[model samples]
Target: MAKTRRVSEEIVCAAIRKRKKRTHVPEADAPKAGEPRSFVIRRGKYAPMLKDLEKDLRQMMMPNTAKELKESRKNVLKDFVQVAGPLGVTHFLMLSATQRAGYLHVAKTPRGPTLTLRVLEYSLMRDVQSAQQRPRCPQTMWHGPPLVVLNNFTGSEHLKLAATTFQNLFPAINVATTKLSTCQRVLLLDHDRASGRIRLRQYSIVVQPSGVTKNLKALLGRRAVPDLGECKDVSEFLTRSGYGSESEGDDPDTTRVELAEDLGKGNQKARQSRIRLHEVGPRLEMELIKVQDGLCEGNVLFHAYIQKDPAEIAERKSKEDEREALRRQRRAEQEENVRKKESEAKRRRRPQDDARGAKRPRPEGRVPWG
Candidate 1:
């Protein structure tokens, strides 16, 4: 009996240990100090805007624009970034329909953060292992569940679509809509006519700014306020039109009280003030994710906490170190090669010098030594 009791206690302890291991850690519940507070913002109205933007972008890529496409894309992306938050463009992948499974776009932000977006368009129904087909970012590992966003649907339809997409993309991962404190993954889904398949995509949002800025001065010229002060309308119109009485009127009419206020003075002050006011662009940092093609509409996108893993950081550092080491090795080898070439050239010339000896003119008094 005592042996059985001892065995039961052991089993109980093992069970407790197993349960502890299975418990999940909610890492992304709160934004880090420097991290932007992530909100699952959604609005379906932005779908049309996305569609139009896609059309314009496609038109720009037609022909003779391969060279200019990069700049054009940045500009286009800038506009998209501006409208994304209001128009709810966070879930659409900003790639063309022809983009393959592993295409990526990177935009630099003026405030020193990089916006990197990638497309992973593979199928879970395939015979291959899902992980093998899953798209991967080199140094990034999303360590939390994502917020799931449903577009063009609401009420029961929204819930249904979210469920269906979640199952299709993340089959085994269990997520709860009510208990959302432990999630950090974002899943965006939309119907794709090009492929005729409901496209499922996963995207993450970290607040970042688009570095490109519209140079107000460059666009509108150095002078923001028009020089109307000196033009005919303000300078000579009243005088030329005889609106102003002659400065020295023949009859000193006291009936019209001499107006003490200068009418043009206020206009001048207003013009100067307008000129002094600098035209600055919007400063709000945009957090937008672009899915190549489709519409994402809903009041709530995916919501999940996000956190960085120490392992991933260590791995990235190791990779950088490896690259630095390789560069040093290559530089050392290059230096060695240069030295070897110089030494070989000197050695080759040394024999030639001996053969040639000193080619000085023989003294007139001295015969050849031979």
Candidate 2:
């Protein structure tokens, strides 16, 4: 946990340092000849309105930076030294209290009671697990009951997986309730952590976006996962046999159509046309079991509480959200890949389309033959 905290502090420091240099216009402050000339921040003349930009940037970077950045640099230093909530002490301790006091620090705080901190030699440790997580953040262990699966053998597997994913993403989901993808990304981070971290561990297997989550209230209402094992994550177990139908060489369009037919109902055939809970359920369960089993086989961490520290929790949640968003964005991008492949397959399967396509008249300068 301490290491995780340390990792978090380092990350924050790096981000602040990075944001500090985010939009630096070295040109704005560079010396044309010899003197480091100071010029009034010229709005719209020599540079983009830097003062406002800096203010806006600080607002996001600085703690609750909505108001005027009335804090002197000295305040930041003081906060670091005395009221070092999460930031370290020495980084702000070895300082001249007089010369460089600026808006950074609100006010000089009396130093806390002295305590010794022994610096240790640092070495890189490699993680070999399969879970996903931030570069290295705390784990969010969801100590909950095992998932319910009275439906089928596949149901047990997927329910467990969905349960783990539910637990893994619970925090992220809370933070980004309005955004499902963000929560999903956080869950994946847990998977990465599962396979990698030595100190912090994560669960394996990632659940698909099933009604498992969107209808969590209903599931919990019905008392899901009554006899769940004392497992950290459900990874080591069986994963859904294959990812999607195509990974198993099943046609997705055919799968979708078959699914629609299986759930056919009277009066509103179109209503059941899209993907259904039953259609996606079996696949979801398989993934759950695979991931759960993986975790059970000593590939998981058993901290129970993923992250207890509020600061770490907040930071990790932010990371989970950011990571998931990227994953979804990447998935969206991958959809383009799926479409490209599908398009090519269509071109191949229906050479007639290609022939017909070639025969179409060109609209000057388009596709050679638009």
Candidate 3:
């Protein structure tokens, strides 16, 4: 027998590095339209549900966002913001919980217009998968960002801003240049005007050849030979109507689409395909609580419940200004003290230098000429 080949550690590591280089998207190669990178993080103590939700959010913002970002209680918003600029991260999705409710803070990096949303209800991915009979979550589904669909997010100024923020979270797609195969997922944000809440749902996009019986589709799959043990003939097997077949009474207008390109094995160009959406969850019902002028803080631009009069707003502004001035004065005083201490240390060092240079009284016995 031939000797078994042994791969050295260095060779394995080099191969891994090479693979990473090929897969990694460098900042220089990013599209001119600017693809937004994000950090989906949780702050403080959180329930298991919220932690899972954070993971699902990270998965939804795939290819560009950090999927396995670790954060501790000691880490602050500023720490992530400081690092985001260098790494080209543009958005932050921070989840936090209190005794009353859970909150999601969506903020643009290093700046203002943070949207605070209260989570009314949520369902994790595991929960949704377990409930479905056939959960479809292929690994290829996460290779690209989901297509965002915003419904009924118009009319109000706050709604418009919220819509814009959600749109900016993902890279824009050019229909002419974009390939159909890359669109593996869909993110739906439906705003309920009556309830004043937004429903978030993520789905995996699947295309199947339309106008084909289930038996024919299975035969084309070729993964395994269908068991024809009970059938009398091959024709009977192929023309079987109700043998382990799903309901196919779906509306043609809503589900059918013309394939612009060859998407997969059975989905060929110009072929009629049926589009189906499988909910891959972390579903949420959220209400916009407030929109702030800064990252997680600063003046509130919009509040759902509370309304402050102009006088109260002016007073608050004045108080903020006064506090800022006080902080500036204290910083200036600290700098002045630091400068004075440096000068004092220099003066002390000069006297020490003089003492060292006294020259030992010029050696009392030595003549001045010598």
TM-scores, one per candidate: 0.25, 0.16, 0.78
Q: Candidate 1: which stretches are off by over 4 Å?
A: 1-113, 117-266, 270-307, 360-370
Model 1 over residues 35-148: C-alpha lDDT tens digits? Answer: 221111111323332343333322212111111222232244445456545532222223333322232232222111222233333322111223344432311213333444
Per-residue error for 288 in candidate 3, Å, reads 0.7
Candidate lDDT scores, in order, read 0.35, 0.28, 0.86
The prediction achieving the highest lDDT against the true structure is 3
Count clashes in each candidate, considering only residues at least 3 apart in sequence or on different chains.
23, 56, 0
lDDT of 2 at 257: 24
As for lDDT, the candidate ahead, 1 or 2, is: 1
TM-score of candidate 2 on Cα atoms, chains taken together: 0.16
Tens-digit per-residue lDDT, 42-126, candidate 2: 1122223223423322221212112232333334333333433332211111111122221111111132111111111111112
Candidate of highest TM-score = 3
**How close to the true structure is residue 278 of candidate 3, measured as C-alpha lDDT?**
97
- Provide the lDDT at 33 for model 2: 31
